[model samples]
Target: MLKIVKTEILKLKRYHILWAGIALMLLSVMLTLFTSMANDGSVWDFTYMIEQVIKNNMSTIFPMCITLITGYIITREQKDNTLKNILTIPISFKQLLVGKLLVCGILSLFLGMICTIFTIMGSFLAGFPGFSVGLALQAFIQITFVNLFLYIAVMPIVILTSRFSSGFLIGVIVAFVYGYCGMFAAGDMKLANLVSVKK
Candidate 1:
C-alpha cells in the first residue's frame, strides 16, 4: 500500500491538472482581494482576508478543484490502459483504490498548504494590516485542516463517480454545485451551527 501510494505521488510530478488545482487555490485568494476592493464599510485585515479566502475556498474553489484533480488521477490508470498491469501485481482493484484515496488525502493537505501560501501572498499584495506570526500560524492550521476535512467530505462522491468512464467530469460539476450550496446553508442559523463549530 505504501509503495502504491508512493507510485501514485510520483505519477503527479509532471501532471498538468495539478497546476490547475494550484491556480484555483490562487484564484480563491484573488477573489477575496477583489471583494476587498468593495466599499462595504468592512475593514479588511490579514485575519479577515484569510477568513474571506477560506470562505471562498470552501464554497467555490477547493471542492471542485480537488474533485477534478483527484478524479482525473484515479481514473487515469484505466484511461491509459494501465490498470491491468497494476492488477497483475497481486493487488485487487479495491486495494488500488484505497491507495489512490490515501494519496488524494495527502494531496488535499498539499493543496491546502499551497492555498495558504497564496493567501499570504494575496494579503501582502492587498497590504492588509494586523499581520503577525500568530495569525499566520492560525491561518495555516485552519486552511490546511479545513481542506483535509473537506476532502473527506467529498470522498464518497469521488469513489462513486470513478466507477464510470468520464464520470469524474460529472463529479466535478456535482461537486461545484454541492459546494456552492454551502453559502446558502450558512444563511440559516440552525444549519450554520450544524455545519460549523460554535465559538
Candidate 2:
C-alpha cells in the first residue's frame, strides 16, 4: 500500500495538474482582492482576509480544483491503458483507487498551504492590517484543515466521476455546485460543524 501510494505521488511529478491546483488556490485570493475595490465598509485585517479566503474556497474554488486534479490523475491510467500493467503487479483497482484517494488527501493539504501563502500576499497587497505570526498560523490551520475536510465531502464525487470515461470534466462542474452548496449549509454551528470533517 505504501509503495502504491508512493507510486501514485510520483506520477504527479512533472504533471501539470498540480500547477493548475496552485493557480486555482491563488484564485480565492484574487477574488477577495477584487472585492476590496467595492469598499464594503468592512475593515480588512489579516483575520478578515483569511476569512474571505476560506469563504471563497468553500463557495467557489477548492473543491472543484481538487476534484479535477484527482480525476485527471485517476483517469490517466485508463486513458493510457496502464491498468493491465498495474494489475500484472497484482494490485487491484480498489487498492489503486484507495492509494489515489490517500495521495489526494495529502494534495488537498498542500493546496491549502499554497492558498494560505497567497492569502497573506493578497492581504498585504490590499493593504490590510493586523498581520502577525499567530494570525498566519490560524489562517493556515483554518484553510488547510477545512480543505482537507472539504476533500472528504467531495471524495465520493471524485471517485465516482473518475470511473467513467471522460467524466472528470463533468466532475468539475458537479463538484463546484456541490461545494457551493456548503455555503448555504452555513446557518448554525452544528450544521456548520457538519461542513468540517473533524466531526
Who wins the TM-score comparison? 1
Query: TM-score of each candidate?
Result: 0.94, 0.92
Could you give me the TM-score of model 2 versus the true structure?
0.92
TM-score of 1: 0.94
Question: Which pairs of residues have clashing backbones in candidate 2?
Answer: none
Tens-digit per-residue lDDT, 49-113, candidate 1: 98998889898898898899889988998898998898999999999899989998999999999
Worst 10 residues of 2 by lDDT: 190-199
| Residue-wise C-alpha lDDT for candidate 2, range 1-199, written one tens digit per residue | 9998998888899578799999998888999888877867988788888888888898889889988998988888998898888888877899999999999999999999999999998888878899999999999999999999888888988887877869988999988887776776676677566554223
**Model 1, C-alpha of 27: deviation from truth (Å):** 0.4
**Which portions of model 1 miss their true places by more than 4 Å?**
189-199
> Best candidate, lDDT-wise?
1
